[model samples]
Target: MPDYKHFPLADTAEGLTEAEIIDWKVKPGDEVTVNQIVVEVETAKAAVELPIPWAGVVTELLVEPGQTVEVGTPILTVDVDPQGAAAVNGSGSAASAVSAETTETAEAAEADADEMKPLVGYGSKTTVAKRRARKSQATPAAPAPEPVQAVTVVAPRPASEQAAPAGYVPLAKPPVRKLAKELGIDLRTVAGSAEGGVITREDVRRAADGTAETASAAPQPVTAEYDPATRERRVPIRGVRKATANAMVGSAFTAPHVTEFLTIDVTPMMELRQKLKGAPQFSGVKLTPLVIAAKAVCLAARRTPDVNAVWDESSGEIVYKDYVHLGIAAATPRGLVVPKVRDADRKSLAELAGDIGELTAVARDGKTPPEAMLNGTFTITNVGVFGVDTGTPIINPGESAILALGAIRDMPWVVDGELAVRKVMQLSLSFDHRVIDGQQGSQFLADVGELLADPAVAITY
Candidate 1:
C-alpha cells in the first residue's frame, strides 16, 4: 500500500487569495524529485512555477488547467512510498494492484478523517466539496413530438392536443439563457447558429433583433471567412494586467494626488550620456536618459525624504526609509509591471544602468518575480519612449510619489542672453498631498531638473 500525500496551493505573496492553474508539468504516474517544478500557476501579479517539496510519484491531479482555486486547496496527490509502489507494480495483476491501492486509500482516510495535513508554506483547512449543478442533471427534457399521420382530420386540434418538436431542447449556456430571459426573448423560438444546433449568445441577440434565420434553413459552412460585425476578439484580464488594474484603482482613490510640471534643457545630460558610452567602465552598459533621471531622483530624495516615504493609513503613521528601492515601470506584452532595483541609491551610474537593463529585459520577458515588484519606495515612468510629451502619472500604491519623463526634443531656449536651440525635456511629478506639501514637492522637482541641466553637479556631491 502506498502512502498518498496531497499538495495544496501555497500562499505565494501578501494579499493573494487565489491562483489559476495555467499548466501542469507532470501528470499522473510520472516520477518526480524533490524541489521539482510541478505546475505553473498564474496569480494576479505574475505567472509562477510551483515546486514539489517532496519526491514522489504523481498519483492524481485534483485540479484542472484554467480553473481558479483558492489558497490552501489540494491541487494534486502523490504516492511517496517507493517500496509500496514497487510491490504493487510487481504484483503484475492490474485488478489486485487497484484493489490494494483502494484499500490503502480507505484505510488512510479512516485514520485521518478528523485531521488535515498542511503542505509546506500553506496552512491546512478542511474544505467542503461543492459540486456544480450541471445542466444535464438539472431539468428533465420534454417528450419528443410524434410523426405526422398520412391522413389527417379536416378539423383543427385544440391547443392542449398539440405536441412539441422531437428531441427539442434549448442549447444555450447558462449566461446565454439568462441574457435571453432578460431580453424577453423565447430561446425555443430562436435558431441555433453553432455546430450541432447549439444556441449561442449572438443567436439570442440576433433573434431578439429579428435578424435570425430559422434553423431549418441550410446551415452555413464553418470557414475562415471573416465578417466585420463578428470579428472582435476578447482577451482575459489576468496576471500582471489584473494586478495593475486593482493597484491603480486603489492608488488613484486612496492617495490625494497633486501634480506639478517642469520643463528644463537637458542638453548637458545627453552629452554626458554620450561621453559615458565611450568610458571603459561603461563599455557594455546601455545608458539612457531614464537612468540619469532615476539617479537624480535618488539624490533629490536625500534632501526631501518625505517623497520616498509611505503614508500608512492603517497604522496611522508615515513610514520613512533611508534606503531607496527604486521602481522602473516597464510595459510588456502581458501588461504593465514595475520591477524594482534594490538599493538603487547605493549603485553607481554604470551599475544603475546595468541593473536597469537587466530588470527591463526580465520584465519584458514576463519573468519578473513577485518579490521584485514589492516594497518600491519611489517609481519612475519613462513615457517619453512613446514619443509623447509629459503627462501626470499616478503614484504606485504604498509609494509616496511617481516621476514621469517626457520626450526630449530640440527646442528654442535662451543661453547667455542669446536665443539658441537646446535639447529640452519636461518632467511631471505626482505626489501624495497628505505626506508632501506643495513647497517640498516643488523643491524636489527643481533639484531633479537642476541635476539634469548640469550633469557635472552630480559629481560635486
Candidate 2:
C-alpha cells in the first residue's frame, strides 16, 4: 500500500486566479525530490515553474498541458512512500522500519515545505474527482473552443527544455515548440526556413518525418489550411493577449485621457548621439533616441510629479510617487508587455540605455518575469520604430500618463530664422485629465522636447 498526497496549484503572484499548464517535467511513476521543479504554467503575467512540495514517487498527473485551472486545484499527486523504497535501498531494514513509522513525518515535511515557499493562498488539497463534481454542479458545460491558430513567430524555451551547454533557445512559436516536444525532435538541429530563422509548423512536421528544409530558400508563408471550407482562421484569446485586451478596454473607458503634441528640432540630440557612439564609456551600449527620451522623462518628472503618479481608486486618493519606476512598452510575439526599469531617475544615461536594451530582449523572448510587469509609475512607448509621426497613446492602467515617441527624420525646418534640413521629431503625451491639468501636461511635454532639442539642456534640469 502506498501513502499519497496531493499537490494543489498555488497563486504565484497577487490577484492571479488561474493559470494554464504549459508543460510537465514529470509523469506518473517518476521519482521527484523535495522542492524539485515539476511543471511550467502560464498565468496572466508570465510563464512560471512550480515545484513539488514533497519527495516521493509521482503516482499521477491530474492535469494535462494547455488546460486552464483555478488556483488551489490539485494538479499532481505523489506516493510519499511506496513500500519504503528509500529505506530499503539506502539503509536496510532499520531505516525501512523508520520510513514506515515516519508516515506522519512525511506529512509534516510537506506542510513545512509549502510554508517555507511564498505561494500566496494555496489551493485546496482535495481529490480531483470531488473538485470535478462540485465544478460541474455549479454551471452548465460550455461548448468547446475553436482550435487556436499557430503563431508564425518563435518563442523562447525554458532552461530545462534547452540543449547542450547552458541550453540553446530555439526560435519556434508556442504551438510549433509543443509539436516538436511531442515528436521528440531537437529544435536546434532543424534549420528554419521561415523569415529571420523562425521555425514553422511545416518545418516541425518535416523534421518529424526526416524531410526538413534548408535556411537558404525564401521564407514561405504558413497557410491557413486548417479548414478549407470555412476559409477562415480563429485564434483563442488567452494568456498575455487576453490580459492585454482586458486592460486596454478598462483603461480606455475609465481614464479621462488628454493628449498634447509637440514638434521639435532634435538635430542637436542626433549630433550628440553620433559623438557618444565613438566614446569608450558608451561602448556596446545602445544609445538610441529612446534612451535620451527616457532620461528626459525622468528629468521632467522632477518638475511635474503628477505624470509619475497613480490613481488609488479603491481608496479614493491620488497617490504621488517620489521615485520613478519607468516602463518601456514592448511588442512581443505573445502581446504588448510594459516591463519597468526600476529607479529610472537615479540611473545615468548609459545605465538607462543598457537596462532598456536588456528589458526589450527578455520581453521579446517571452521570458519577462512577473515581477518586471508590476508597479510602473510612468510609461514611454516608442512608436517611431514602426515609422509613424505620433498617435494618442492610452495611459497604462493605474498610471497617470504615457508618452509616444514618433519617427525622427530629416524635415525642412526654420533653423535660427533660416530654412534648413534638420533632424526633426514629434512627441505626443497622453495623461489622465483628472490627475494632470492641461498646463502641467503641456509643461512636461515642453520640457521633454526642449531637452531633446538641446542635449545640453539636460544639465539645467
Writing each residue's lDDT as its tens digit, candidate 2 over 234-313 gives 66677787888899899999999999999999999999999998888788888999999999999999999989887888
**lDDT (10s digit) by residue, model 1, range 91-115:** 2543444334443442243123223
Error of 1 at 40 (Å): 2.1
Q: Which candidate wins on TM-score?
A: 1
**For each candidate, what TM-score against the reference?**
0.70, 0.69
Give the range where candidate 2 is weakest over 10 consecutive residues by summed lDDT: 145-154
Predictions in order: lDDT: 0.75, 0.75
lDDT score at residue 64, model 2, on the 0-100 scale: 65
Candidate 2 backbone collisions, by pair: 72-123
**Would you give me the overall lDDT of model 2?**
0.75
The deviation in Å at residue 306 for candidate 1 is 0.9
TM-score for candidate 2, residues paired by index:
0.69
